[model samples]
Target: MTFLKRGVPLGIAFLMGVLMAFQYYVPHEHSKAFLELMTRWDKIIAGFAVFIGAYSLFHLHYTRIKRRAAGWGYSFFVFVGAFVTIAFGLYNGGEAFWHDKKEGTMFDWIYMNIQVPAGATIFSILAFFMASAAYRTFRARTVESTVLLVAAIIVMLGRVPVGALISQYIPVAADWIMGVPNLAAKRGILLGVSLGAIATSIKIIFGVERQYLGGGD
Candidate 1:
């Protein structure tokens, strides 16, 4: 058991390293199986980690309520919401909103009315700030600045009813700018992100990322 706690992990790490190193060239059924197994294991682990978050949240809220903190009312609300949600969820046989409407009435109301509107309102506020920032950055103070300013103006007009009446090319230019340049940049970023994720996953699988498993001292 001690050997497994030490030697077996090392052996698995070494094997995984070799397999990953040769995976690109070795496009076989075994490689496909390994990838599928890794994917499902990741999803399973991620699903289980939700319980850890829920437990921590519950403990934090309970402690605040017990100490009669300044925001104890908020903590009480949190406790009530989480407990109600859990109760209804269990009533539905531990599945997602599969039961009748009465079973998940409070859960559905809180989610639809409270959570959704707040999320949308926050997003709307952020988008307003983004547009303001864009306007500040895109002001025409120089020749180069004027070029970006012109592009921005054109794109903005193209997004509305006015540009189409002036010329069809305005919208076409906007589409090219958004589709080609934006897509290229986002694609590069996504590829880098995916590689980083894969590297992080490999580190976790090799026990190099013990923090994820609540193993930091």
Candidate 2:
């Protein structure tokens, strides 16, 4: 506290912090330069942040192995995954001076064939699980709950032709749910979210928030 309470860090933080906040409102050439400087600073900080995360990943596994913690094998899994990906992604093709050989092609293969299907499979299970959970937990506990459960079921069936064939009511209900009620609710949510974002941006501009600058304790 003694050193930092009265140091160069405090002065720089106050000055840069003012420019960071004011750049959002100020329209002069000076404000433009300040904004550009902040943008570059952001990219530089992000690069260093990535390095810090990588170091954390490496250190965590190394410590696990050193301590022989239970389920340490899982840590090895992370190490193996990272090493394999890096190895294939680096040496699979000849490298250009600047062009990345495996970034788009090889990594994308791993993502699509493996990650995308896994994600979809998990998402597909949600319907069955939702039905079971609603049946067990909801049980039409109240008028509001009953309405919610019915609405969920109707929307779920509306996506498929089978639902329409089974009952014509489903398609109509789904149309109302999606076209009117759901759309209105989504619009309200989006508007609220936008307002929140604008408020946060203004706060950062005014230096009311310094969490992003690593200046917080």
Candidate 3:
């Protein structure tokens, strides 16, 4: 049982990871063909993943509703929204389920009128939260924090017409700060992230990282 659950998955991960990593560097026709085949398989696997994710979401909400857990009322909306949207999609604006959905379909109407507005409202609410977080972050308690606050102020001001009215140099300084220092910092962070990802991939390929197998053991 241990071998079937752990060993098999680890072995498969290592083999597939190594093969996919090398596929990029190999210039042979066979390598290209193999990459294409794997790409198709990836899409098929992704389709299955979507179903799995839906099942997991449904199961979670179902359990919450069944238990009458805290905020269980919200779970009811999950089922309602999902069912209504799916029904509208399948109904396909009375064109029959087999027909392709076009612009005037019920699915499109729900997506445009209901989902889009809801999404926009949610983002609008998020702007306030982001402002509050930025306020907290921009406190000039330390030298680094002071520098960050200054840079953020310059960028924000330079983006608006008022900054240009004050002085042309404000915009030039803002552009210089963003184009040079900000870009350099961003590249450094990206380099670190890429190296971390490579290290983690190597660890997984060598079976040193088995968290994906589940459980602390």
Assess candidate 2 and give its lDDT: 0.78
* Candidate 3 lDDT over residue span 1-217, tens digit each: 8788788999999999999999999999999999999999999999999989999999999999999999999999999999999998888888768987656887888899999999999999998998999987778899988998899889988999999999988899899999999999999999999999999999999999988889843
TM-score-based ranking, best first? 3, 2, 1
- Greater TM-score among 1 and 3 belongs to 3
On TM-score, the candidate that comes out on top is 3
Q: Where does candidate 1 stray beyond 4 Å?
A: 1-34, 63-72, 93-114, 132-153, 187-217
Which scores higher on TM-score, 2 or 3?
3
Query: For candidate 1, lDDT tens digit of each residue in 22-105?
Result: 775778999888878877987998999999999999999889988998878888888777777678655554454564545446
All candidates' TM-scores?
0.62, 0.69, 0.88
Candidate 3's C-alpha lDDT? 0.92
Deviation from native of the Cα of residue 26 in model 2, angstroms: 11
Model 3: what TM-score? 0.88
